[model samples]
Target: MRRHILPPVTRPILLLFALAALAGCGPTAEPAKAAADEHGAAVDEFERGPHRGRLLRSGDFSVEVSIFEEGVPPEFHVYAYRKDKPVNPRELTLTMELTRLDGRVDRFSFAPQGEFLRGAGEVREPHSFDVKVRALEGGRAHQWAYAAYEGRTTITSEAARAGGVTVETAGSIVMAELVDMAGRIEITPEGQADVRAWYPGRVMALNAELGQTVRKGQVLARVESSHSLQTYSIPAPLSGVVIAKNSNVGDVAGGEALFVIADPTKLHAEFFVYPRDAERVRAGQRVEVRTLSGDNRVVAPVEAIVPTADIASQTLMAHVHLPPGASATFRPGMGVEGSFQVAAWPTALAVRTKALQRFRDFTVVFARVGNTYEVRMLELGRQTPEWTEVLGGLEPGTQYVTDGAFLIRADIEKSGASHDH
Candidate 1:
């Protein structure tokens, strides 16, 4: 029995080993490695493919791009021709398309020209035109549209890509906005208020502290007639608060104020204006007064503009009327500082104060188009304390930097930080 059991167990074990060995020798493959290799080939082909662009239509004018190698800007320059005569100045339009990775396409167009090119010479002169572009992030097809002025008629057309460019530099590039240039005026006063003894009276009943409200004709203190010749009651002429008391109870009549009363509503400010600005400081111009005490800004109308200027100071004094609402809370001696709305260009373009930048030579501002920032040259006009008048280079509806403008300027000054306009 032991011999038969041993043979059966040994034979079964031998058969199992033989089957496993045969299975191990069967077919096997590196599937993952093969897949990876195929993906690499696909990527290479995508990167090496050609990008094609064509000028679908062009005005009698043409533009050449030289600054940016491929994706960079400062690229397009335009030239005009009249007939075949090379008109001293020609008007033009164009269209262009960009084809990017993954078969994506982009298109762009140019704004109409308002002015003819000055001093146009024959033989294709060099000029730059700023066109609006739509980005095709990763595609091969894009379209451009432009307009050309050829005397009577305008020409519109599309341009295609001549080549594709790849950038080797690696880093981050972002477009940022910048502040406009501005001017500010700071002044120190040289005039003082005149203080005099108001009246000499007898002490009456006391009714107020240093800052207490007293109505006009209100009896602050009553005095029994010390002089029989003057047997009339004395009353306050102005409604104000008592600031000082010279005499106490039961004192003899002295020629001093028993209670000092001042009218807070009668506050006045004298602002000096240059002779050039004097013409604008008429009797009815609007004025704005600003004080550092909270947000207590006062807007008032000009009451009068004194024609005579202080000869020594070479400045004219302009007196503005404050509103009763403002005068109620204001004190006479409180200092007020701000600008006068002398001459207003009602149709002028303006931006907020915080939008300006103080540059060494000329003021600079960034014009925002979609997500891109464009450098702008500005000619500034008369400026109010809160807003600056834009003389040139910017459109009215454009959004500009109001706060954190310096940060935008810093970003722009950095190399490769701004997009070409």
Candidate 2:
């Protein structure tokens, strides 16, 4: 070989150009190196095909697999190319096998559709799977397998604990089916009394104030009898709290009520049962009474169901007797709510309401298997305020995520490892 010498200035320029060409080749060689992996099974995480899908390569052939979910169920779309040239999709048959993180294996076959192939059936969601593709061309089989996961991630036990994630085991529970109704606290008729003027008189002095406790025959006021003009004492008719005081000092008293008293400890909850649930409201049934704010709850048995229904509301009245100590938290005329238990059943599998989540089209619970949380679908039955009866889809003693499941879901979505597969 003959050596030709160039000027020093030209030599530097040629060297710079050579270096630039090599740097350009660096990027293009990356995809070639990835394609040269064992069986051409390499996943370019940052690269996607024109259809925004995973690109799998085997020898001279490349296939782009995408999920098209526009106005239809999710199905696979596969586009084929041979050595950077668009290959006729009709000359090839493609099939795919997906093994999910939960150990579920799904096989899909593609059929020729216009310029590409479409997979049969709808692809499931949370698209995390190990993918394998086989393409039959000219009586020869070319295959590639790679792990392609979207919207899936694993968190360590320490991280989970730091994030407040908690778990509980699924088990059996006794659930009560209840009929909810509106109610109010009322003083029973026998528990209330009205203080009246024994004789026509003039009130001379008033002692009892509104809401004051008075004993039976306690002097509430002194009055002067109009007949004899003699000042006499007026007394409370019962030992109860004074709810109303209508008389004032030095006022003339007639046959009208001077004071209203009620025994707060002898109160009852009166619930109105709508026509739809009136038949289920029966005496002796178990009832749970709660304030509208849900701060207080009292379990009492139904004392009676009134025979007549309210004409305007068409609701039957059910009364529950309150214990004497109920006066501490409840008062007459206070609005309340009550639930009457009409049926009860034993469930073999149950979980807390917080453990349930809506993912895709299924109600799912996250089951902790080792360090991995697997999504478990649920078939639910009757539900209560705290527990939900599980009819199927969960086994007893299975530990599931309860408190911080949404956080795990957020992590999975952030990882972009789950999608409709």
Off by over 4 Å in 2: 1-168, 200-204, 222-237, 250-252, 324-329, 359-361, 369-372, 384-386, 416-421
What tens-digit string does per-residue lDDT give for candidate 1 at 273-355? Answer: 77666555577666667553435667666666678878897777777666556665554655666456555545347666446
List clashing residue pairs in candidate 2. 127-419, 150-416, 150-417, 150-418, 151-416, 151-417, 151-418, 152-417
Model 1: C-alpha RMSD to truth?
23.3
lDDT of 2 by residue, 29-122 (tens): 1142233222222333334667777666655667788889899967899998888577788989989898876566889999989878899987
Q: What lDDT would each prediction earn against the true structure?
A: 0.39, 0.74
lDDT of 1 at 44: 13
Tell me the lDDT of model 1 at 163.
Answer: 11
Q: TM-score of the candidate numbered 2?
A: 0.57
